[model samples]
Target: MPQPVPPSWKDLGKSASDLLQKDYPIHGTSLEVKTLTPSNVTFKVAGTRDSKSNVIAGDIEGKYVDFKNGLTVTQAWTTTNLLRTQVELENQIAKGLKLDLATTLNPEKSTKAAILTAIYKQPSLHTRATVDLFKGPTFTADAVVGHDGFLVGAEASYDVQAGSITRYAGAVGFSAPEYAVTLHGLNLSTFSASYYHKVSKDVEAGAKAIYDTKSTTRGVALEVGAKAYLDNAAFVKAKINNAGVLVLGYTQALRPGVKAAFGLALDTTKLNDSAASTAAHKVGASFTFNS
Candidate 1:
């Protein structure tokens, strides 16, 4: 069997912030209230509901920073049948090194799990190593090196108790003002390449191809997508894949702190069988209020 390729910086997809700003319905109705003071103290409360599942959740969190000691503390609570608490402490050990310690506790069960992480940074390279001291020990480490427009990264994970390496991946990529490309691999047998280009000031296009070396049939898939920015704080994106699946989404900001989005997905192959099963769609709206 082929050893898994370690993860590198190249595997990261669109970030949550990007998706949220694009009005993706990944999160249903969300409301957040936050307060910050001059002394680096902060408090926040957020609530969300899943329109499809009708599940609701809320979180309350607070943070305090001691700049003189280079330390910060954060605590959070999640509302549920049994309340869960999480606490984290971060300290800067030196100019370019930091440590993070965190734990999650379930009061009802009196059970807890801890995590420790160390991060180091330099002008051209960054590294992070983390350990989970839970039921079974696990370790993960990754590093990235970059200069100018080119970058490369590698990542690996091990199961300490099992005494074996479990995960590995890597990526190499470059970005220019007008174009970007990345090659990523997993477990030696699976690989993918992606390319993106700025077609114009308001439009962008991208494509991706994936291959599995071990597969006898259906070993490859391809997808292409594009985005267009319209006037007045609105944008649209569309994508299609070799499997005859298409997705289209549109987002618009009505005013400050208010946004709405709609998305539609269609399987052309399913259309050939039945029209009712061919299309799926979702609509979402969000509002934020700050004091």
Candidate 2:
């Protein structure tokens, strides 16, 4: 039998988090437009405006991917007149090993770089390590072990100059075709439980609860979300948090190569409060075109 590689430690609870957060409606007024060319280059412009319709903030970014050389380059300019660039190179070193190097540059700030190495040793063992060089080098590593449908993983980051561990976390999860569950902990203070279920071919549902032992509040923070595919080219998603914050989004393919999305966010508790009505709702839209 072929050895099936397991997910990285960072992605242990990704399924649930993605359902609850990713592609969800944007909060506040904003618009984003993106265009992708056939030559593997993407151009994007996005911004939000104030009540007077004056552009308040935004950025323009362009990215190009060179598959023939295993390289990707991204550059962006912000409304603040800051220029930033990122370069990434990736390659497979062996059957189950891969190397990735990435660098970030900002003339206004500082430059940073990191090298990541991943190894899939067997059907049950997978490991990833990253070394960030610059502004106090740090070493971070994580490993995931799987047995049957169960998985356990831990991650830690060490500061070389300080000779100390900055962060540590662990997670355990079980995966099935229809459902998955994960429990995670960070530094023995913050804990989270996430569950994802595939309700049907067209629908997905997920929920997550977070509890901080050091939190002054005694209750857990909860979020529940779901996604439903209306057809091949349209989908809708909604999520709500414990604090009565609700988010809803709908995406549709406007044409063969164009897509549009509309999003809304609302605070249910403030709907009838005149003093807080002004901040009770947000809306945004996005469009994408790909060749």
Candidate 3:
């Protein structure tokens, strides 16, 4: 088989943007302010001003670390119906074992949610498990184990009111220094597979295929993306999916503690069908400052 060609800097940027959007969707305009102290403490405040919706949302967070005991604590507040507070703690139990706990509280309503997670690692194996008891009587549990480049994971959620398992998922994956592949099945009906390869030191590419067996369409959606580094400080990326959606993004570092980014998405399929209907375009910009 022929080897895949390395992506260009532009492709690399687009791939990064695509993955980032999966975890953190871009709203209108946003600003983030962060500060770090010599004592290993940090503070952050971030907000989004969406002129389109005439709304503003923001959060403030503080974190402290105790290097001696391998312990870390984080507290955050967000604008909720009645300002919500959340706290997370992580501590090393032993050389290869760690524990993590987090909780969110609604002071006005006297409601709270909590989760606990544990991780253990050895020279050849790593494992993590988490339990979430957030809503009144429902709960969720998930666990994953990895060894020798191979991984297996499972997750299940229960509804106390219904007295049954509401959701479940399982995944398997294999990873190497130059390539990785993963397959996931959710609720026994939805399945997704992903493949990634490092074409070169400065470039990489990936693809994902998804199908829902229970759906009427029964068609698989394929997404392909690539990313490349222009240099140490800047890059561009692009991705296109079976749905005919295209995304492009770029990022550059202006200087220490300052960075800028821009992204755009277009409906290529609409443009192909009719020039007049090609109105699905979005653009976003963000700036970050650190001290």
Candidate 4:
């Protein structure tokens, strides 16, 4: 019988234990290394124009990475950043300055109208640069100088449901948040310095003052307005464009990265000393895409 085969099993156990002990440290270190991923990294790529609309409109750019520890990188290409085009800028000016002749004045398809026709169509022939400056704050001086289109202050109108007429005096003023600056205490046609501020994320409040050179008709007005984002895809705004009317608008994000903006504007204009007022409502819309 014999205590005989206590078995070589003891030798097998010892070998197994030795192997486990030797590998334990290595296995733990491997796990720790996996957790401590490298951090320093960088990536770059080019982008193309966004063409969500019939016309291409913007540029794109993209990137992501860390640069602290080792090089662990991530990156993305970006879209081109396209700004408003000359045509788009001209459209904005037209929308802002356009008069509704179909209703305000009699519609005519003829080659003859009046000072009004020239007033309405003058922008079309003007260079793109002139068109861009039409309603902009920076151009009142130039407008007064007659280097381009007329300024808002230059034309005073009196419109009513009965009739309306506008007297072109060629005036200009710098519109600002608290106050406006005029060229001369007399020449309301030129503004020296203009400043404006946002009252809220969607609201703006401001004022403007103009001096009359030929007459003692210096005047000033207080203004208030709002811009509302209806949704991630839509928005509406109501702002005062001039003394007589308000501007109301709606904009929709039509597609992924694409948008359309449209507005119905009401302008109050004076035609004569009668102090009559009229309505000139216009609807304008444009589409834009950002890649």
Candidate 5:
């Protein structure tokens, strides 16, 4: 009998993933209270120095709306982000939708909620890109008494996703330690909170907590991060988790409507009981333009 083994395990995909952006979300509307009704689009091309490699470029087309008060609404048609980056070409064509809402209750208090869902166009060997939705509510307060800025917020979500695993149903069957395996379920939750305070006019620090639970396991990672403005040309920041994982990042403003940012992080993961620990060091950079 021929033993089962992974076929065609190439580093083509692995090498391309290393040089992508860490934080793709654009930031600037943090404390602004104006109606920002506009349609935005962006593209990012990432690749290594290898001439034989293809640069993976992604495009995000979305619309953002902010009311005169503190109410905010955003709708997006994102090609791929967290879930879509893993699979092959057929899976890459999958599509998703996101809706978000944020409002201010008082001069120093606020609330927010969001819903996101995505599904694949076709089933691949690994997964069919199952449907997943996240819905949660949060409350926040900031700058209560003589503080430059302060905030405390919490939220939770119930999510469902297609199992990223597959099994062959034949006499030989898929090679596994067990005959029957748990496929997929809709019972998962994630909770998170953060509090930010400004120490000076050009620097700020914050603490955050993120707790995630799946059908099989649960874990939490705590983080501390800071941002500094080094004049108008350069800035740097750093962060780390309780598990000794580290993240260092920086962004530089270039010209009037163009800027770039980069980040690096280290983490580990275990796929199954028999699987060995996989260590990954990731780096990403992004450029943006606005008129």
Candidate 6:
């Protein structure tokens, strides 16, 4: 009996959560362009704006991969306080093992941080550990074990300076060809459950519910979503939450390497209110090109 486990405990409910949250929408307009060069380098540029007139944020990034040494290097510059630079390196240590090192530096603020992470995996087990080299020398670790389509996992983090545990969580899940479900307890105070189902070749649906044990209001937050494939070139998604918030998204391929996405979010409870601005409604669009 072979059961595949998630990379980390945090991914226990990733499938259902992604279905309900991912590709839903953004709050502003954004565009991304990328190209791969013959020299084995990839370059990307992305920009975002609150309105159609001016660009509010943007970044340019480059990445190179060394297949022989199993290493990848990435560098990025973003518009923040003149500019911010981020560098990352990932290397495969051995079979089923890898290490990732990343750093972010802000010259204007004179601030920088570094992090290191290691990942290991086997047929029925997976584990990951991370450390913040400068801040608290914090330590975070997680592991998952699976057997016969069932999985269990746990994760915890500790801050060396605080001399205490910062957070802890656990999860259990079952995966099948047609459906998957997961239940998790987060930080010993919050609980969540999720389910994903594939109805047919072209339709999929998912739902998630979360509850806070510390909340006086015993209400659970629930969200349900579905994705419908219209054709090979286009798709549509819709989701609604317990707060009467409805979201819709559509993505279409304009050509071989170009795609566009449009998203809208509305508050049904605010529809009857006399005063409603952009607060009650939000819309955004995104375009992507890969060459």
Q: TM per model? A: 0.76, 0.85, 0.81, 0.30, 0.38, 0.93
lDDT of 2: 0.81
For residues 27-98, could you state the per-residue lDDT of candidate 3 as single tens digits? 467778899999998999998876457588888888888877777888888876334333333345467667
Model 1: worst 10 consecutive residues (lDDT sum): 12-21
lDDT of 1: 0.70
**Residue 15 displacement in candidate 5 (angstroms):** 33
Worst ten in a row by lDDT for model 4: 26-35
The lDDT-based order of candidates, best leading, equals 6, 2, 1, 3, 5, 4
Alpha-carbon shift of residue 1 in model 5 (angstroms): 81
lDDT tens digits, residue span 1-291, model 6: 554645467677777888887675557888999999997789999988975345689889898877777777888888884343333333454677878888888888888888888888788898999999889989999999988878889999999999999989899888877889998998889999999998997999999999999989988999999999999999999999999999999999999999999999989999877588456878899999999
lDDT of 6 at 158: 98
Comparing 2 with 6 on TM-score, the higher-scoring candidate is 6
lDDT of 2 at 114: 50
The lDDT of each candidate is 0.70, 0.81, 0.69, 0.32, 0.35, 0.84
lDDT measured at residue 272 in model 2 versus the true structure, 0 to 100: 86
Candidate 1, residues 1-291, lDDT tens digits: the string is: 322222235334332113222544443576677778788988888888876776889888888888777777888888763333343334445776778888787787787888888877666677789899895599988887767757688888899999998889887877666877777788787898888888888988788888998878755888888888997688888877898877777877777655666666667667655545623333454455444
By the lDDT metric, which is better: model 2 or model 6? 6
- Please list the residue runs of candidate 3 whose C-alpha ends up more than 4 Å from where it truly belongs after superposition: 1-26, 81-92, 108-111, 134-139, 159-163, 272-279
lDDT of 5 by residue, 1-291 (tens): 323222111111111122122332221111111122243222232222211233343333333333232222333222233211221122223332222222212222332223222221111111111222222121211110111111111112323243222221111111122111111111235444444555676876666655667525466667766667899787777776787656677778787666777766655332242333223454555565554
Clashing pairs in 6: none
Report the number of the highest-TM-score candidate.
Answer: 6
For candidate 6, the 10 contiguous residues with the lowest summed lDDT are 81-90
